[model samples]
Target: MIVKRITNVFFRYALRVITLLFAVSVIGFTLVSLSPVDPVQQYVLSVGSVSPEQRAELEDYWGLNDPPVERFENCLSAILHGDFGTSLLYRRPVIDVIREKFANTFALMLCAWVFSGVIGFILGCVMGANRDRAADKILKRICLLLCSVPTFWLGLLLLLLFSVWLGWFPIGFSSPIGVMNSDVTIWQQIHHLILPALTLSLLSFANVALHTRQKLIDVLESDYVLFAKARGESKRQIMKRHGYRNIIMPALTLQFASFAELFGGSVLAENVFSYPGLGSAVSAAGLNSDVPLLLGITLFSALFVFTGNMIANLLYGAIDPQIKESYANE
Candidate 1:
């Protein structure tokens, strides 16, 4: 019975993900089609002008003469067969480019995610535990300020302060220029990564911290906590016995749900730092009207975010048996 329930849950989420991908593909393709950028014209500018005959051949080759529905159908068919089509901007297979760019992006986001979660949770705990003390008041003000600052603006400021003024990190890019890829050590990559990751982390952690603080405070005000206080239980003791569990689940939900925001922010962060990741690639694809590349990225991103939400739900069941039983019964 338990196995069957788990299978049902998995199947349900799987179907939802499929439907979401299809919708995203349709919407992305429609938007790209409506974009004013003429991909062929952009390509021509990149490669120098071509004769009218050559231009016509290019259009026929790309199936630009076909109806939008026909073109989308053909593209969908090819994708189902494991072909993502070629990128107009990079002139490489879309899958290949995405693979390379996604690796860089994954590293940057992972660092930011970990840092944000850890720092935010710690700050939230501190603020909640201290209440209206000086420490809490100071951190709350800082979080409020950070919540208002844009990610790109933060990246720029970090760029100027750390890279330009302090000269502690590189100005930009995933690695130092002129150095062969093979010669780039792990430390070199990390050095370049610090500012971008820090920028993203700082931009991301405030919401988590603020949410966690409020949740903790609510837990502190619960009847059970008041009863414990009347029983002469110290604040620290009650927090240890009652606080962590109650607040953690909500904080976990918030943390996991941040995957999409981090992904979106990476685009602005990556572009600001000139990092060669999916964010930069997507930007180029949009600017140049690389339909296949843009659509592929859109579909992939939808799956990515959907997976995060699914994982959060699954974690909830794992961490709480009551939740699992309810799901099983459903």
Candidate 2:
């Protein structure tokens, strides 16, 4: 019975993912169709002028001669067969380019995600426990300031201060210049990552910190917390036992939901820093109208976001057994 229930849950989740992906693909393709940039013309301009015959061949090659519906059908068919189509910009398979770019983006995002969560949670806890005090007031002002700053603007300022003026870090890129990719050390990559990751972290942590602070405040004022205080539990003891237990789940949910925001911010962050990541790739694809690449990225992002939410849902079962029982009944 347990196995069957788990199977049912998995099946439902799978169907939802499929439906979501299909919808994303349709919407992405429609948007691309509406875009004014002509991929073939862009390609020709990049490669210099071509004869009328050659232009016709290029249009045929990209299936620009076909009806929109037919082209979409062909694209869907290729996707089903594990081909995301070749990128007009890179002249490479969309998936292959995405894979390479996403590796760098993932590393950047992972660093930002960890730093934001850790710093935010800690700050939130401090502010919540010390409400109306200097610490809380100072942190609240900082969060508000940081939240208002744009990601790209922050990246540029950090780059100028730390890299240009202070000469503490390299200006931009994922790795050091004048070094072969194969020869670049892990530390080199990390050094380049610091500014962009910091920018993203600073921008993102505010949301988590504020959300957590409010949640902790609520939990602290609850009846059980008052009872604990009456029972002679120290402030620290009450927080350690109850405050953390109640707030952790909500914090996790917020963190996971922030993936979409993180992805969006990364675009600005990468462009500002000239980092070769999925975000930068997205910028290039859009500017050049690389439909295959753009559509592929759109679908991937949808999947990425859905997967994050799904993981959060699954974790609820592990974190709270009542949630698990509810899932089983469903």
Q: Judged by lDDT, which candidate is best? A: 2
The sequence of per-residue lDDT tens digits that candidate 1 reaches over residues 131-160 is 999999999999999999999999999999
Q: Against the unseen true structure, what C-alpha lDDT does each candidate score?
A: 0.91, 0.92
How far does residue 308 in candidate 1 sit from its true spot (Å)? Answer: 1.0
TM-score of each model, paired residue for residue: 0.96, 0.97
lDDT string for model 2 (1-330, tens) is 889977987999999999999999988888888879788877888799799999999899878889999998998999999999899889999999999999999999999999999999999999999998999999999999999998988898999999999999988899998989999999999999999999989999998999999999999999999999999999989999999999999999889989999999999999999999999999899998887899889999999999889988888887977887777677
Prediction RMSDs, each to the true structure: 1.3, 1.3
Count of residue pairs whose backbone atoms collide, per candidate = 0, 0
Q: Write down the worst ten-residue block by lDDT for model 1.
A: 320-329
Which portions of model 1 miss their true places by more than 4 Å? Answer: none
Q: Which pairs of residues collide in model 1?
A: none
Global CA lDDT computed for model 2: 0.92
